[model samples]
Target: MRVSVVIAAYNAQGYIAEAIESVLGQTVPPDEVIVIDDGSTDGTRSVLERFAGRIVALTQGNSGQAVAVNQGLALARGELIGFCDADDLWTARKQELQLARLERDGELDAVFGKVQQFVSPDVPEQQRARLTPAVEIMPGELKQCMLIRRDALMRIGAFDETLPATFFIAWLGRAKQGGLKTAHVDDIVVRRRLHPGNGGRLHTEAQNLQTLMALRKAIKAQRPPE
Candidate 1:
C-alpha cells in the first residue's frame, strides 16, 4: 500500500534537510512527502524551494502543529499516514518495516515503534519499550512514533486543534473509542531531537502542565459511570 508522510515544520532551517533526507533514504520510500511550512521567517522557504518537486510544500500563517498536521491530513492521499517531526530522523527501514507489518496484519489501525529522545549534539541511542495501558485509555502516552491508517485517522477527526502538546492523549482516546487495535514495533524507529530552541523543550513545565490538564479532562470524559 502507498503511504504519505507529513512533516510539520516551523523555522527548521537547521534540521529540515536531514528530516527530508531520512525519509528519502527509507528502504520503501513514501509515495509523497508533504511539508507544511507554518510561516517560518527563517530560511525554511529557501530550503524547501531547493527541494522543489521532491516535496509537496504547503505554507500558511503561523497557526501551530495541530493545524499544520490537519492541513497535511486533509491533503494526504495514502491509505497509510505517517508523521515525522522536522528535527528528527527516521530509521532507514522505517517505512519498509512498518508497511510490511501492516500488510501482514491488515486489521491494525494504529502502529507505533520505539523512539529515543536526543537531548544534545551527540544523540545516544536509547532503547524504548512500548507499554500497553490496562484500561486502554491512559494519559501521558501517544507521541511522535507511529504510522496510522488514514481511514482511522479521518474517523478520529484528525488531530485536535484545541490542545497542542497533549493532543496525543486525545487521539489515543479517539482510537479507543473507535475500537482500533493498537500495535507497536520493537525497534527504535524515530529519534526525537531535544534542544533549547525546540518548543516543548524550552517550555517543558508549561507544556507538561497543559498536557496533564488535557489528559485529565479526557480521562474524566471517558471514565465509566460509577
Candidate 2:
C-alpha cells in the first residue's frame, strides 16, 4: 500500500529539515510528503522551499497543529498515512516494519511503536542542565509513532480543531470507542526531540485541562442510555 507522510510545522526552521530528511531516507519511502506551514514567522518557509519539488508544501495563517494536520489529510491520497512531528525523526526502518505488520494483518487499522526521547543537540549545556533527562524508551501512542490506514482514520473522523493541546488524545479516545483495531511493536520508530519551544512544556495547564475534558467526553460516549 502507498504511504503518505504528513508534518505540521510552526517556527521549526531549526529542525524541520532533519524531520523531512528522516522520512525521505526511510527504508520504505513514503509515496508523498505533505507539510503544512502554520504561519511561522521564521525561516521555515525558506527551508521548505529548499525541498521544493520533493514535498507538497502548503501555507496557512497561524492555525494550530490540528488544523494544519487536517489540511494535510485533505490532500493526502495514500492508503496508509503516517505523521512525523516537525522536530522529530523517524527511524530508517519505521515504515518498513509498520507496513509489514499492516500487510500481514488485514483487520488492523493502525500500528505504533516505541519512541526514544532526547534533548536537541543545539540546546546549550546550561539550558539542558535545567531540562528533564531523556526517557531512553517509552511506549508512544502519539501521532509521530502511528502508521494508520486512511480508511480507519476517516472513520474516527477529523481531529478536533478546537483542542490544540489534546486533539490527538481526544481523537484516540474516539477511535477506541469506535472499536478501531490497533497494534504495537517493540521497536522504536520515532526519536522525539525536546527543545525549549516544545509545545507540551509551553502549554502544560491547557494540556491538563484538555486532557480532563477529553477523558470526560470519552466516558460520556461509552455510557449506556437509560
Candidate 3:
C-alpha cells in the first residue's frame, strides 16, 4: 500500500528540515511527501524550495494547523494517509511496522504507537525535570500517530476548522464514529520535541476555548442516548 505523508508547517524553519529528513530516512519510504507551508514568513519557504521535486509543496494564508492538515488531506492520493508534525521526528520503521501490522490485521482501520519525548535544546530545564518516557493517548482519545486508510479519512468528513487547537480530537472522534477499527502498536512511532515554541505549549485563550468546545462535542457524541 502506498503511504502519503502530510506535514503541516507554520514557521517551523528550525526543525522542519530534520522532520523531513527523518521521513526520507524511513526504512519503508513513503510514496509521496506533502508539505503545507501555511504562510510562514520565515525561511520555511526557502527551505521548502530547496527540496524542490523531492516533496509536494503547497502554500496558503496563515490559517492554522487544522487547515494545513486538511489541505494536505484533500490533496493526498495514496491508499493510506500518514501525518507528521513539522517539528517532530519519526522512527525509521514507522511505516514498515505500521503496514506490516496492517497487513496482519486485515480488519483494522488504523494503528497508532507511543511517542518518545526526550530532552531537547528547545525544552527548558525546568520543564525537562518533569519529562516522561512515553506519551500515549487515552483509551478514547485520538491522535495522528498512525497510518489511516485514505477512504476512511474521506468518509470521516472534513476537520472542524473552528477547533484550531484541538480539531484533531474532533477528527479522531469522527473516525471513531465512523467505526474505525484502530489498534495500538507497542513501538515508538514519533519523537516529540518539548521545545518552548511547541504550538500546543502556547495555546491562546481562544484556542483553549475551542479545544474545550471540541471536547464537549466529542463527549456529547459518545454519551448514550437519554
- Alpha-carbon RMSD to native, per candidate: 5.9, 1.1, 2.9
Which is better, 1 or 2, measured by TM-score?
Answer: 2
Order of candidate numbers by TM-score, starting with the best? 2, 3, 1
Please report, as a residue range, the 10-residue window in candidate 1 with the lowest summed lDDT: 127-136
lDDT per residue (tens digit) for residues 24-77 in model 3: 899999999999999999999998888898899999999998899999988888
Point to the candidate with the largest lDDT: 2
* TM-score of model number 2: 0.97
**Model 2 lDDT tens row, 1-226:** 9899999999999999999999999988999999999999999999999999999999999989999999999999999999999999999999999999999999999999999988888988888865555566899999999999999999999999988889999999999889999999899999999888997887789889999998998899889997
Which ranges of candidate 1 are over 4 A from the true structure?
Answer: 120-143, 223-226
lDDT-superior candidate, 1 or 2 = 2
The TM-score, computed over Cα atoms with residue i paired to residue i, of candidate 1 is 0.86
Going through the candidates in the order shown, the clash numbers are 0, 0, 0
Candidate 2: regions farther than 4 A off: none
- Among residues 3 or more apart in sequence or in different chains, the pairs in candidate 1 whose N, CA or C atoms overlap within 3 Å are none
Candidate 3 weakest lDDT stretch, 10 residues: 133-142
TM-scores for the candidates:
0.86, 0.97, 0.88
> What stretches of model 3 exceed 4 Å from their correct place?
122-142, 204-207, 219-226
